[model samples]
Target: MVKNAYVHIPFCKSKCKYCSFVSYPQLELTKQYLEALQEEIKYFYKNEPLKTLYIGGGTPSVLEVSELADIIENFRFDKAAEITVELNPETLTKDYFKGLKSIGVNRISLGCQTFDDEILKSIGRRHNSEQVKNSVELAFSAGFENINLDFIYGLPSQTIEGFAEDLKTAAYLDVKHISLYGLKIEDGCFFYKNPPEKLPDSDTQADMYLKAIEILTGKGFEHYEVSNFAKPGFESRHNLNYWDNNSYYGFGIAAHGYVDGVRYSNYQDFDTYFKFPHVHFLTHRVTLKEQLEEEIFLGFRECKGINVQKINEKFSIDFEKKYSQILAKYTASNHIQKTPQGYKLSDEGILVSNVILADFL
Candidate 1:
């Protein structure tokens, strides 16, 4: 049974450049979208005991506080559920957050792309450095103890010193969580045509990433995942569910779901996503081979590598039997260790993880 769920609110005040996630400008469709979302929960979940509830979005805070509460109230969550909502810092207000607290949203993942005003507007973020600061203060004042601030490194025109400054400022805050992201430019956004000048070199980006991992780790924060850091006991439970290959119900346009060994998503277009009167979900069961592929891919995303013993035990197949040649290649090269507990990537292997995951595939 799926015990965790992710609800994607595909509504943004305006789209950000370099973003390809399925969300649209929600200027007038907020009410209708919430209704559709409620119908979605009612139709699919039938009210299970959700251990973790994540309300991610183009911008979830776009909804009125009351609308946000009504959306959150649709679920029956666990007593100590880790309920998180993604908020654009610009949309937050003091009153908006108090209602959010009352409605059981205990975690706020604020998108504070960069503390520098220059970088903020360049990336099309609505909030400036001060607004970002104020929104975090607003949430903290309203009794939100768990907050995750997101910032991107390796932006088109960002410098290493600028990136470090942003991290230092956030660290100075009493915030318990940080999510660092690397910028990826794609088609259909401002970056596609007018990609910024003097983008950070791959080597520089790697250096920046390593610097962040080192700095955050030394600051009493655990580098639990490639892009996430947390103080002790504050690591994200909802994301851990994904890395562990546990099942979850994914709702909204372009949101992905895994249930009963199946993986699928609804159509990406908003018109199609909202055309249905009631909740609509589509399922595509994974072939056993596909499931195994995903297990390897997702597990390696964490600092803790995959457990070979568990895979062999659960799948009832020898790792050597399935991929003897691949295992021989990496093991001989010292890219992996066939440990008693499991197979783990070597230090060199962690940096080239994409290449490692592709080896099994």
Candidate 2:
């Protein structure tokens, strides 16, 4: 029943200042890590022709093309499946892109956080702006028409004008998708210990977001999700599987997966992961009430909000009566609107989406 899969590669040449994900800079662990990852997949993968497969990482691109191929060969994919790999621009080579295409990788997500070299250094990224440009050109030449560029706003020394320029540059690259995120200093990150100076305030960050929505939508990208924009059919299918609450397999250290109403995450420590990669460090059986709450919170993240009729039918509850107060307050305040499909977040609502979405929970 699982149709989507995610493989985490924790290896990186160097870690970023704000990255809190479980990633290691040790290259010596590459061989053993891949072997353990394959074993984990072998244990859980159902051998179905998958709908989507995403290889995300500290740096999946750092591995040799042959090593990447060996891992992919174990999985069976649909003929037209969306296979995506997260690539660090500096690690990409023409031959690597070619090898990926040969192995049926149809999508490429390049981490081009910003086009400013000074900001790049400030954040500890290894690649320069030129490397990002070359990486996109190489991906296109390798026959990957579905490409996504990830950019961040509200970084140290970032300005509204600078972020707008970055978006303009991204649009010029002919990419099919863009993921724009605001920087947050989470615990365990270098930024948490040493906070960056001149970071954007909440108001400035909101302005930056609104500006991006104007620019990207003007360039024909659909604002499908809170942080993602895409061309009509280029929305990330793998991610949509998550928003839709579908079951999938997640493999590797610190990777999380939801299956049969239970959510589980693998161990975070490398030694413990090698000992038992399939054993979950945390597991929670979601209750029906929690599922209903999640369906609303996650669904609202997309432009297409929760379907009232569907919720009523599926949960056998009066959708309107249950949330009558919430509906009345938000709609009256112009934060939500009724549509032919269902109730959706207003444009203004999307600006404060996190705050409003919490009310649903």
- Predicted model with the maximum TM-score: 2
6-106 in candidate 2: lDDT tens per residue? 98999888889989988989889998888899889888887988999999988899888788888788899887889999999987888899999998789
Worst 10 residues of 2 by lDDT: 352-361
**TM-scores of all predicted structures:** 0.93, 0.98
Residue-level lDDT of model 1, residues 58-81, one tens digit each, is: 888787778777767778888999
Rate residue 38 of model 2 by lDDT: 85
TM-score of 1: 0.93
Q: Model 2, stretches more than 4 Å misplaced? A: none
Off by over 4 Å in 1: 277-282, 324-340, 346-348
User: How far does residue 334 in candidate 1 sit from its true spot (Å)?
Assistant: 5.5
* lDDT of every predicted structure (CA atoms): 0.81, 0.90
